[model samples]
Target: MDWDKLRIFHAVAEAGSLTHAGDQLHLSQSAVSRQIRALEESLDTTLFRRHARGLILTEQGELLFEATRSMARRLETTAARIRDSEDEVFGDLRVTTTMGFGALWLAPRLPRLFERYPNLRLELMLEERIVDLPMREADLAIRMKEPSQADLIRRRIMEVRIRLYASRTYVEREGLPRTVEDLVSRRLIVQNPASPQVRAGGEFVQPLVAQANSTLTVNTYFGILQGVIHGVGIGSLPDYITAGFPDLVQVLPGLESAAIPVYLAYVQELRHNKRVCAFRDFVLEEITAHLRTIAPASE
Candidate 1:
């Protein structure tokens, strides 16, 4: 029941040796062994199985280690919250989103955020895997679909669609197609049909890939964008990417995928945290500005 003993047990279990754990804790091996013995006495259970090579946890030790690991994560979260100044926005903020958006949109705009709060540190995780916000896998997430996970505070931020684009140089050389059928004569660049992407994008991509005279398939939208930018071919890319790339000419203005809703979410506990709120506000403002620029006539 002693917190200090539990701490020592955690370290010993992690290190798998009393001597190693002792070195880390600034205690001698004898002292570390004494504490573990006391903890085992209090719990009436063996925590580890000694081996010639090292140590391995017993069944009981695994259970205790699970609790300790959870405790460690929660403690880190608590410490981060405590570090925040209610009136100031500056600290380590982990933000997760799709690779395409992170690389093309959010990452480029982050400099302004830094200018406003020089102390603000950001960890941008760009992946398809949905991070567990409540469990603190990430401090916040910007995802293509609404997060169905629990204990999350979510806001619908924007809508995006897969659309066709090509570099101005390509358009000048190959000429722009006026209709879907017109694309049959041109080289079509797109996301690989096998890659994990939004349903709308995947659906839109299949038909185009099937009929083009020539094709280039990239695994990511970033790769497709590069091909389009460098005049490789007409590429299918998310519309939001165009906000930052003015040189990319929309090949067929009328052709696009159904709108995919984008959501920004965080653990409910972070709703009032200064750094979280500041980052959320900054993103919303940027999204608004982006929407205005992308669809000025609609607005």
Candidate 2:
């Protein structure tokens, strides 16, 4: 019922220790303990079970924590919207994308963003999990497929295909695979089965990896790219990478996977946010530049 008490309870529940929660709330441990006791009295329910290790949430506590967490997320979203100045593209901008694309493509081009808006603070979340943009888990997302989540504005940024590639030196030394069958005699480098990747990439890699006599499997595309660059073996890599690593020769070019659509998405609420607009435009400009650079090679 009391917002202040609810806030304190949420912090304590999250930290699982009164002392730790006190450190975060800038209150004394005894004061935090008193607040928890008062909250329990008001609710007439034990929220936590004490143990030697730490505090564990009771069933009622879990329910209350979930509600409080949702409240926190909503408050954060509101605060972000309020901080978005009409004329200035500044403040925190959280962007989520796959590890490979974030590290390989977006990270390299971020300097241009900072040069334009030095006051902007960017948080890059590179992982495979699809964060909830509408719920404000992340401000924006660059995903391998279109986001099906409602109340979000999404734009198809580009398409990518998983194709076989190897360094020029490796292609010259071992020769290119004339057919998929030829891979049986050569080592193949690929993303491990457990790695989180687009369905197209996974499908393209399995058959080639199956036929190889020797194989090196890495969890991330960045690792697979490294292996290919060092001549470890032929690798299944996204075609976008070729723009940056032009010397990497395509192998069995005819054998490639279906196109994976890449989408840039954000909550509809952020449509007018200057920071969001600036970032969206920046990404489109970069993608256009990349396409132009690779046009001659493709032709």
RMSD per candidate (Å) reads 11.4, 13.3
Write candidate 1's Cα lDDT for 145-226 as tens digits: 9999988899999899888999999989988998899989888888887877889998987888888889999888899998
lDDT (10s digit) by residue, model 2, range 203-232: 888877777789999999899899999999
For residue 212, model 1's alpha carbon misses the true position, in angstroms, by: 1.5
Models 1 onward score TM values of 0.71, 0.71
Cα lDDT, model 2, residue 111: 96
| Candidate 2 off by > 4 Å | 1-87
- Cα lDDT, all candidates: 0.89, 0.91
- What TM-score does prediction 1 earn? 0.71
Candidate 1, superposed: residue stretches over 4 Å from native: 1-84, 297-299
lDDT of 2: 0.91
